[model samples]
Target: MLLAIILVTLIVLIMLRVPVAFSILGTGFLGLVLLGGLGHALPILETAPATAVRNSSLSAISLFMLMAQFMLMSGLLDSLFDAARSLVGRIPGGTGVASVGAGTAFAAVSGSSTAAAATLAQTSTKRMLSEGYQQTVASGLVASVGTLAAMIPPSIILVFYAITAEASVGDVLVAGFFPGLLIAIAMVATMYVGMAFQKGAVPAGQRSTWAEKWKSLWHASPLLFIFVAVVGSIFLGIATPTEAAALGALVALILVVARGRFTTQKFLVAVAETVKSTAMILAIVMAAHVLGHFLTETRTAPKLVQAIEDSAMPALLVMVLIAAFYVLLGFFMDQVAIIALTVPIVLPVVEELGYDAVWFGIFMILLAEVGMITPPMGLNVFVVSKSSGIPAVVVFRGAFPYVVVMLLMAMVFLLWPGLVMWVPNLMG
Candidate 1:
């Protein structure tokens, strides 16, 4: 009863618009006091921030954020989008499809879903809307494609999951490759289908001349190089994710300087943004750790796992319930908070039920992606709205089909876990 009350109170606080970090921290502090007295709780509160900050993996968050900020400031994604448009924009729904491609390409170097959505939304929405595409389709494509960052390699969410779950960061990063590709393909397919049935959902784009296409490609090549350098280093076992992030940030800085786009003010802004984002993420990590410690003291995970095992529920059904629970929770919570709060309680049950942690990470990322584009609290949707000057409801409307695609992808993973595990297996 105490545990239930604690969880319900935390949920209520989140719904009441309390800052997530503070809500989690306060709830955890209260739970710890109730369970183990102030003496036990005080030590954990005092120590969690330091311990979490000590994780070297946490530094990658800042480095990757810097890399992404530099890329955005360099205006390189503009050329990348042009190149993708030149290559595909002549087909029906092509601009929308190009947005997906650009998002995928950008996700290789960007560890953030919001950054991907905002950058692409700013670039794609105007072109698509100008070309007669519907507002929802234009903004929604940007929002849905942004979620590609969540499952793509170099994803910050994957890094956080690895550190929290004590799984191999390398394996978890590699595991995302195929499932990410699967989701991207699904997004494109959803666009194509919408174009078919909705007529003007996406209008055909002007074709680029061969000369223009080559020029666009030339301008985009540098950004592509950064992607190859960062992701290739990881895929080829040349560096850890942290090393690759540093290399990518350095390369981005070099590229910006080479292009004469580097400004001290912009660089400082990037660094400041990196610090701000890193602090927010780490604070959540610290709070979640405190809460997790309290939950563990209550043996909640073990008890939950035992209950599932003793209920005669098939492993597949249990997995479905877990996925569904994540999707529902995602409607109300941010992905990082969802992962931090639930993984501690749910992961052991998943492992006991014979699911691989790496595979489950991919599964959870898919749910996260869905959550990012869902109605009401869809962060990416609102980002797209703000970036494109479109209404949030329009973005959400456009995202509905893509949300179905995500749900279908989740089912595909449930049916064949190997799709999520194959690349990671190749990592050995």
Candidate 2:
């Protein structure tokens, strides 16, 4: 009854358009009161919020967000995209593929999918649309491909998952490297195939000159160095994950200022945006803590775990079901909120099934990436549409093929866990 009430109340509040954080916290608090009375619930309410704020792992969130914000405002994002375009612009549907490539590169720096989608949408979508690309193709590619940002290394999602699941943040981040690259490769291949069949869909354009390409490459070198420095130091044991983030942010800021792209106005704006995004993420996380606490106190997670164990479902099938649930929920909820609310319930089952926590973390991120492009509530779709002034349907249609690619990538990871485990194993 308590679990059902919490679930129902959360759903109702979400349907009523309550902010996700509030809905989670309110339902959890209400459920706690019902289960243990005001005496117990009040203390939980007071204590959980403080505990949530004091969490050290959460410091990574602000640092990473600040890094992304500074980079975006610094104009480095555009330089990276231009370099990607120069490299891939000659192939069929190359612009779209370039967007995915650029997005993946940006993901290394930004760490958030929404920021990637928003930044790329602002940079690439307009150009693609104005160049006469089909609205569906342009919008969909951006929306779906932007998800690569979250799968790539330096992902905020991976960091959060690592912290919450008590896994190594560096290991989880390293584990994502290959799978994220695979997704990008698959998405690019899908674009090539789609363009092959529908030749007129993506017109071939003039290939960039060697000189021009080299110029763009030179301009993007700083971003590459930042990536190598941060991810490399962690992999080499020279710096911890938190230290890498701090170093990355500092390097990014230096690059921005050296390029003369960091104005006082832009700096302030980046700070403001970082604060807003970070606060929103933290709020949902705190609420999730409350929900997770309630679920644990009520033994709801244990009951579910026992039921799953009793069922004769194969471990692989269980993973598929969980992935499907994420896809469905992704349509309605933000990825961070979903992770926070479900990780406590799901991670224990994953452990019992004998999967590596770091590997499972990558799997979860891949699934969430798919969710970002999947439906009526796909945030990236809305972002792409808004940026391109294209209809959401067009974007959804364009993203369909990429979604298949993501699903296929998920299946590959499921079948050959080595794709995710290899890097981390090497590091260990």
Candidate 3:
């Protein structure tokens, strides 16, 4: 009955448009007061925020967000996209493919999916459309590639997953590298196939000269260096994730300033944006912590885990169900809010099933990336649509093939866990 109330109330509050963090916190607090007394609930609330913020691992989020902001404001995204265009523009649907490539590269530096979609949309969508690309194709490409922001190293979601799962942030970050790239490649391939079957869908264009390609490549080298320095150090154990983030942010700032892109105005905007985004994420984390405490006190996670364990279905089937749930939830919830609210509940079940937390984290993120492109409520879809003036349905159609690629990728990870485990294993 208590679980029923908690679940129902949370859904009700959410449907009423209450912010997810507040809805979870409010429902949990009310449950605690009713079930365990106000005395118990008050202390938990007071401590939860402090405990959530005290995590040094979480500091990486703000650092990475700031770095992303610097990169976005400083025109690094533009450079990368230009280089990608020069290199791939000759192929069918090449601009769309290049958008995915650029987003993948930007993801290494900018950890936010929405920011990636926005930045890439601002940089490439209009141009792609102007180049005679289909509107749906242009918008869909941005929405799908934007999700790479969450899969790539330095992802804010990965940081939260590390803290919640008590896994290494660096390990989770490193584990993401190959899988992220694989998804990017798959997305590009999907574009190629889509264009191939539907002739004239993506107009072919002239290829750049080798010199022009090299110049484009030269302009993007700063981002390449930052990626190697930051991701490479973490993967090689030369620096902790937090230290790497700080170092990355410094490098990003320098690149922006050296390029004369950073004005006092731009610097202040980046700082302000970072603070606002960080505060929003932190608030959700704190609230989710309070709700997590309540769930733990009630033994909700264990109960669910036991039920799953007793079920007749194979563990793989259960995993698929959970992934599907994330897809549905992703349609309506922000990725961070979903992570904060669901991980505490679902992770125990994942562990009981004998999957590595790091692998599961990667899988979960890949599922969430689908949500970012999936529907009436897929945030990235809306972001790209708004930026590109393309209809949401068109973006949805464009992203449909990529969604299949993601689902297939999820199955691959499930069947061959080595795809995700290989990197972390080697580092060990």
Candidate 4:
């Protein structure tokens, strides 16, 4: 009964526009106090923040964020996009497919989808619109592809999920690799096919000479190398995620220096942004641990799992409902908040049904990313709209096709499972 009321209060808080971290923290602390007394609630609130921040697994977040910042500062992201566009821009969808291609590459560098979305919005969206693509397609493509960052390697969300679920961070990161690449490939194919029916949007491009293509790729090689070093090292079991991230940040720093873009001010700005971003994530992490404590003390997850088990619903059906539930949560909540708030609750329930912890991490991220593009509170859509000067509704419409692509991909991997886990299996 108390758990139900806490959930109700949480919903009420969200509906009232309370900040998510606070909503979660307040409700969790309240529940702890009411159910187990202040003796229980007070200790968790006091310690969770410190404990969560000290997690060795989470150190990668700061390092990866720094790497992203350095890449952004060095203008490597622009070079990478141009390089991708040069390679794929001559295709039927031109900049649209190129955006997906570039987004996939950018995903390797910036774990934050908003960073990818804003970059593409400022660069790709304008070119796409000028190429005669519909505003919805143009804006939606950017918004959709930007979400690639969430599932691709070095992804902050994947790290958060792994830490919360007590899974191997490296395994979780590796698991997302194949599915993310498949989704990118699907988005590219989707773009080509979608453009086929758009009539006037398909324009023949003057294909670049091999020499020019090589030139663009050569210019962008540093970004590629960083991505490879980070991901390859992980896949080969040559480095921990934190070590790989540190290596990535170091290489990105050197790239900034080589480009003559390194200024003390710029470096400090990157550091500041990294700190700010990490701080926000850590606060939510703290709140999650506190809530996780409450849930654990009350044996909430065990009871819920037991009840669902006895209900005798097929495991697969329950899993589908859970996937839908995550998508529903995405519509209204931020992805970070959703992961922070629910992973503690849902992970155990799913694991109880024999789901792989690493697979669930990727599955959770993919579903949560739908919220990033869906209506009412789509974060990526708003970022694209603001940066591209397109209407949010149009961006939302634009993103719908990609959203469908993601959902279909989710179901595919869920059924096959191996498609999502083979790379991790290889790593093992």
Candidate 5:
């Protein structure tokens, strides 16, 4: 009953606009006090933040964030869009196709959905809009593709999930690659189909000559190399995610300097942004650790698992239920907050069902990402709308089809878990 009350309080706090970290911390500490008295709760409240930050793997968040920030300041994201456009902009729905292509590439370096969407929206949305593409279609396609960042390697969310679930981070990162590609291809195909049926949905581009395409590829090569080094070295076991992130950051700094755009101010700006993002992420981790402690003390995970098992439902059915829970919560809550709050509860249940942790990590991220493009609170939709100067409803309308594409991809991953596990298995 105490657990039920505390859970209700947590939900109310979140609904009342309290920050997730504080919501978790307050509810958890209160629960701990109620269950164990003040003496037990006091030490935890005192030590939780330090213990959480002491996690070595957590350092990867900062390093990767630095790598992404430096890469962004270097102006490589624009080059990525241009390169993809040069290669594919002549096809029907070429601009939309190029958005997916560039989003995938930029996701490799930026490791952020918001950054990828903002960059493309700022640089490509206006041009695509000018090219006779429907505003909703163009905005939706760009917003949807930005979600690739969540599942692609170097993903911040995957890193946090692996840590929370006690899974191998490297394997989790590797597991996302194929599923990410599959979704990317699906988005591109959906774009093609949409363009096919609608007249003047997308205006054709002047096809670039082979020579021009080659030049564009050459311009994008440096960032591509950094991406490969960061992700490749991790897959090959040459470096930890943190070490590879440092290496990537260093290479990005060098490239920025080489491109004659590096400045002390720009470097400082990157560092500042990295610090801000890292701090926010770590705060949430600390709060989650506290809540996890409360959950452990109450045997909440075991009970939940037992309750589900007692129902005698199929494992796949249980998974679908969990996915539905995530999607429903995602409509109203931030994805990161949803992951932080629920992973502690759901992960043990997932493991109890004989699912691979890495596969579930990828699956969970895809589900969370679907919420990112869906209505009422879609962050990507708002970001694209603001960046593209389109109405949010227009962007939301555009994003609706892609949301279906994501849901379909989620089903595919569930049906064939090996598609997510294959690359990670190969790494072993």
Candidate 6:
């Protein structure tokens, strides 16, 4: 009965358009008071705000965000996009392929899927259209690739998941690489196949000279270096996640200064934006802690676990049902909010089923990413529409194939968890 009230009140608040952090915070605070009186709620309310933000692991988010901002200020994304185009642009629907490459590269730095979608929509969509690619194909590819921002390393979502799951941040971040790479492969192949079978999907263009490819690759090498240094350092035990982030940010800062792109305005903007983004994430973390406390005290997740056990359902079937529920939530909520709300409840059940928390972290993130391009909210789709003036419906059609690809990949990941854990295992 108490769990029902907690769930219902949270739903009502979310439906009323309350901010997620506020909604979760209010629901938990009120639940605590109701469940154990003001005596219990007051101390948590006072302490959670401080403890949540004080997490040492969270510093990595600020640094990685700052690194992305600095890289943006220096215009590195354009270099990476141009380089990808030079290498891949001759293939059928090649510009669309390059957009995915650019999107994933950008994702390596900027963890926000919406930011990746908007940037690529502005930068790549026009080129894909000018290159005689189908509008649906061009727009859909950009929107779809944005979700990669959540899957790639240095992803903010990974950090959030680490905090919530009480898992190793480095392990979870490392685990994303293979799955992210596989998804990228599938997305790119979908483009190649879609263009090849369908006449007039993409008009053939001149192949790039070897010289042009080399030049573009050379110009983009530093961006590649940053990605390697950050992830490699963490993988090789040379730096902790926070230290890797600092190193990445420092390199980005130095690069901008050397390139004469550093400006007081851009620097200030980066810092200010980092502060804002960090604060917002911290709020969600704090609220989630409060909510987690309420759930734990009420023994809600344990009860749910026991109920499932009592029903004697197969673990596989139970996991599939949980996956479906998460996807349904994805339609309405972004990954961060969903993680904050659900991880506390779902994680114990997941562990009880003999799954690794690090693997589940990647799994949860990959599922949330699909939501970015799916309908209703489909935040990435709207971002592309707003930036590129592509009709949402057209983008939706474009994204549909990738949606199929993601669903298939989710099943693949579920059946073979080692695909995610292999690198993390080596890193250990």
Per-model TM values vs. the true structure: 0.97, 0.96, 0.97, 0.97, 0.98, 0.97
> For each candidate, what is the lDDT?
0.86, 0.84, 0.86, 0.87, 0.87, 0.87
**Candidate 6 structure quality by residue, lDDT tens digits, 205-261:** 547899999998988887876787788899998999999999989988888998899
| Native-structure RMSD, model 4 | 1.4
Off by over 4 Å in 5: none
1 versus 2: better TM-score goes to: 1
lDDT by residue for model 5 (1-428), tens: 99999999999998898988899899989999999999999899899878988979988778878888888878877888778889888877777778888999888887788888888899778878888889978899999988999899888888888888889988988788889999999998888788778877878775889998999888888987787888999999999988887888889888888888888998899899999888888888888888888999999999999999899999989999998888888887876788888988898899999998889999988998888888777999999999989999999988888888898899888889989999998987
Per-residue C-alpha lDDT of model 2 across residues 1-428, encoded as one tens digit per residue: 76887798899998889999999999998888888899988888888977887877777778888888878767888887789889988876678877888888988788878778888888878778777787777778788778877777788888888877879889998888888888888887887788778868887764899999999999888898679767888889998888888888899899888988878898888889889988998898788888877898988778888999999789999989988987777777777888888888888888887788999898887887776887767888888888777888778888999888888888899889998999999997
Identify the superior model by TM-score, candidate 5 or candidate 6: 5
Candidate 6, residue 168: lDDT? 92
**Model 6 lDDT on a 0 to 1 scale:** 0.87
Q: Whole-model lDDT, candidate 1?
A: 0.86
Can you tell me which runs of candidate 4 are displaced by over 4 Å? none
lDDT of 4 by residue, 1-428 (tens): 98899889999999899977788889889999998798877878888878877888789989999999998999978877678878877766666777888898899888989999999999888887777778988898899999999999989888888887889989998888889999999887777777777777556554677888899999988887788879989989899999999999999999999999999999999999999988888888887777777788888888889999899999899999999999999899887888888887788898898889899988878998999999878999999999988989989987888899999999998898899999999976
What lDDT is reached at residue 373 by model 1?
88
Off-target runs (Cα >4 Å) in candidate 2 are: none
Report how far residue 81 has shifted in candidate 3, in Å.
Answer: 1.4
> Candidate 3: which stretches are off by over 4 Å?
none
Deviation from truth (RMSD, Å), model 3: 1.4
Off by over 4 Å in 1: none
Give the per-residue lDDT digits (tens) of candidate 3, residues 129-158: 899888877888888888888888989889
User: Residue pairs in steric clash, candidate 5?
Assistant: none
